[model samples]
Target: MDKIIIDTAQFQRTISRISHQIIEKHASFDDVVLVGIKRRGAEIAEMLQKRIFELANINLPLMALDITFYRDDLNQANADPIYAGVDNPIPIENKKVILIDDVLFTGRTIRAALDALLDRGRASKIELVIFIDRGHRELPIRADYVGKNIPTSRSETIQVRTEHYDGINQVALLQ
Candidate 1:
């Protein structure tokens, strides 16, 4: 069973606060790019773009990434890594990339994402934004912007429910 931690209202507040922080950090959106990890992460990035546009009236380019091929411990038993690349509509070269993800745990996923991103183009800067940071890092990666940090043991898990997938925005703790 999963215990609900952050509710929908709280999730919205977290996103709104993060959007403000984004605006405060960047002088302009012209040189900034939002790259979201597939599925939940992509949806959250879209929300961030909308929130930023709603607040500053500046629409930033958003890109979705699938990093399956870039994984170090990739199980290629079922799928081919070469065919795992997602469609990148915009170029990230010379732009400040804001890498978005739903959770940050082993940091391996982020390392894979970085590999996938660099394949597209060289970004001037790459900053991470994680909705939940569950702390069990196998690498030195960290999120520059985080919505919430929930420490968990190896036996526990954090599940982020989003509107598109779960019909609601909720963070749950599973033990």
Candidate 2:
């Protein structure tokens, strides 16, 4: 069966809450930069950026990251890897780096993201923000900011759909 975990309204609310949490912690986004994983994560990052701007008039810089090559299981995966490139022009040194991803599953992706991220520049702090944290961690990584925590099994899949990327805004569980 398939289950709808988060609908459009919930998705919007979650993004707003995440943005507020960032604002509360940083007070100002002067030294903050948002780095989103490729595909869906990029869309989420854009939403958060806009929400933060609306809330505090802060226009945080955003960078899109494609960790296709940094993945450890890239060779074992059944799909051809593609390079979409990363958008990081601003100096990340001594700045707060927030890595955004649609879903945090095995933490392997986050690990790869960290590797790709650090290779670019050294930041004072690096935090993770994930829309859904469906636990099945193979690594010791964890998200600093999580929109929702849905305990899931290995046989299930959690899909996050966004209007910007998927033509829909919702989170679904496929079993």
Over 69-132, each residue of candidate 2 has an lDDT whose tens digit, in order, gives 9999989988888898987656788899999999999999889998988888899999999999
lDDT of 1: 0.91
- Report how far residue 115 has shifted in candidate 2, in Å: 0.4
Using alpha carbons, what is the TM-score of model 2? 0.96
Clashing pairs in 2: none
lDDT string for model 1 (1-175, tens) is: 8999999999999999999999999887779999999879999999999999999998998888988778887784576555434655689899899999999999988999999889999999999999999999999999999999999998998999999999999999999
Q: Flag regions of model 1 displaced more than 4 Å.
A: 76-84
Taking all chains together, each candidate's TM-score versus the true structure is 0.94, 0.96
Error of 1 at 172 (Å): 0.4
All-Cα superposition RMSD per candidate: 1.8, 1.1
Q: How accurate is candidate 2 locally (lDDT)?
A: 0.92
Candidate 2: list runs displaced more than 4 Å.
none
